[model samples]
Target: MKKLLLTAGISALLATSAVAQTIGVSVARFDDNGLTIMRNGMTDHVDTLDGVDLQVEDAQDDVARQLDQINNFVASGVDAIIVNAVDTNATDAMSVAAASAGIPLVYVNRQPINMDTLPDGQAFVASNEVESGTLAAFQMCQDLRAQGKSGGAQAYMLMGQLSNQAAVQRSKDFHDVIGMDMCNFITLIDEQTANWSRDEAQDMMTNWISSGEPFDAVFANNDEMAIGAIQAMKASGLSMEEIVVGGVDATADALVAMQAGELDVTVFQDLAGQGAGSIDTALKLAAGEEVDKTVFIPFKLVTPENVADFLN
Candidate 1:
C-alpha cells in the first residue's frame, strides 16, 4: 500500500509539471493604459492554467525590437506566439518565421493591414474600436453643445500610432461620429497623431497653445493623452474646465478624474479582458480544444453619473 501511495504522488508531480503551456505574449508599447490592462488580463489567465507560462514582451513601438522579440520566441520554441504589431506590414517576416517553426501566432488588439489573411492555426481578437471612437466623439460633442457652443468652435485631435489599424479606424470613426449636422460649425483645428505618448502630447499641446491656435476643446485619442492634455492645460494657464477634454481607454487615472469633475468624458475599452482572453484562446487552440475565431470586446461611454457604478 505504501508503494502504491508513493507512485500516486509521483504521478501527481508529473501532472503538475505539465500544466502552463509556454506562451509568448507581446504588445506594441507598455506605456499605454490600454496595454497595461490587457497585460493584467494575460497574467491572470496564465495564473489560472497550472503549467501555462506567459512571457510578456513590450516592443516599445519599435519594429526592430518587436522583430527581435518574435525571433527569440520562435527560437525558444514557445508553444504559442502572440503579438500586437508595431508595423503590421513589417510583421510578415515574424508570421513567416512562425509558420516555418510550426508555432501558432496570434495577433491581438491591432490587426495587420498587409497580411490580408492569417495563416492556419492562428486567431485574432480586439475591442470594437469603431464604437469606442464614436462614443467618445458623441460624448464630447454633447458636452460642448450643453455649454451652448456650436459651429466654428475649434477643437484639436491628439491621436495614436497612425500605422496601427485600430488607430486608423478609430480616427475615422471619430470623424464620422462628429459629422452630424449640428456640429457642422465644428472645426478640427489640428488633427495630429501623438503616438499615444503623454509627454509628446504635452509638448504638442504647448506648441499649439503657443501658436495661438484658436481651439477650445482637445480630443485626445486615448486616456493617456487626455491626462497629458490636462498637464498642458495647466501649463498653458488654462483650467480643466476651460475646454471640453475627451479620451478613449478609461484607465484608473481617467476614471478618478471623471469622479473628481476634472475630465469630461471617455469610453471604457475594457482592456483587462484582452490579455486574459488571448491567453485562454491560445491555450485552447494548443490543446486542441474549440475556440472562437474572433472575439471582440465591447466599449461603453463613461460619465460622472455612471462612474460610481463602474468604479464599485
Candidate 2:
C-alpha cells in the first residue's frame, strides 16, 4: 500500500509540472504574408520543445483586441507572452499589464515605439528595417545604372502601412540612400501608401498608370505591394524590360515573381530566425534566464543571381 501511494504522488507531480509550462502568443493579423511566415516558425519551435504548451490569438489589426488578448493571457497565468503588436505606440499599456502580472513579455516581428520602458522580463526580436530598405535601394540603383537609364529615370515608391515602424524606417532609408551622390541621378517622381495591402497597391498603381506619369522604376516596401504593382503595370501594357521593380521580404510569391522575370530585386528578412528567436527568448525568460533587451537577425539582398539560395 505504501509503495502504491508513493507512485501515485510522483504521477501527480509530473502532471503538475507539465501544466505549468504554457506560453500565449498574440499576433496582429495572421493574414499578412510576413506574419504568416513568422507563425510557421513559431509553430515549428513549439513542436520541438518538451512539455511546453502554446496558445495563439489573432488580433485582426485592432489595438484594443491585442491588448485584451494579452490581458486574457495574464488572467489565465500563462508562463510567458509573445506579442506581434497591432500598433507600436500602444506598447506602453501592454508593458504595464504584463509587468503588473509578473509575466515575461516578448515582442516579435513588429517593434514597439520604445524599448527603454519595458520592465526586466521583456525583450524584442526582429531584423533592422533600415538594412532591408538600404539594400533594396542600392540594388534598384545598380539595376537602373546597368540598364543605362540612371540619369533622368523616374521612380515611384509604394509604401507600407504608414503607422508601422518597419514601413516608416524602410521608406526613410530608401530615400536617404537614393539622395546620395551615386544614386542621386534617380528621381522620385511619386510616392503613396498602400497600407501594405496587395489590393490597395493594385488600385494605387492602376491610378498611377491612368495618370500617364512615366516611371522607370517602382520601389515597394514589401513583396505583396511589389506583386500588385507588377500586375497593374502588366495590365497597362508595360513589360518588365521597360521598367525596374524591387521590394523587401523574399516571400515565396515574390521569389516566384523574381524567377519569372517579373521582379528585379527583393530583400530577405529571416522569418524562421526571428520566430525561433522569439520562442527561445520567451522560454528563457520563463525559466529565469537572462536575455538581451533586443535581439536582431540579419537581412540579406536577394536577386535572380542569388535567389536560388533563399528558395529553400
Q: For each candidate, give its TM-score against the true structure.
A: 0.90, 0.96
Give one digit per residue, the lDDT tens place, for model 1 in 9-70: 99998988776479997788887677888888888767766777878899988899998998
Question: Which candidate number maximizes TM-score?
Answer: 2
The CA lDDT at 39 in model 2 is: 88
Candidate 2's C-alpha runs over 4 A off are: 5-12, 15-20
The reply for model 1, stretches above 4 Å from the true place, is 1-20, 114-116
Q: lDDT of model 2 at residue 108? A: 92
TM-score of 1: 0.90
lDDT of 2 by residue, 157-226 (tens): 9998877888899999889978998899889988999988889999999999999888889999999999
Q: What is the lDDT of residue 36 in candidate 1?
A: 82
Error of model 2, residue 210, in angstroms: 0.8
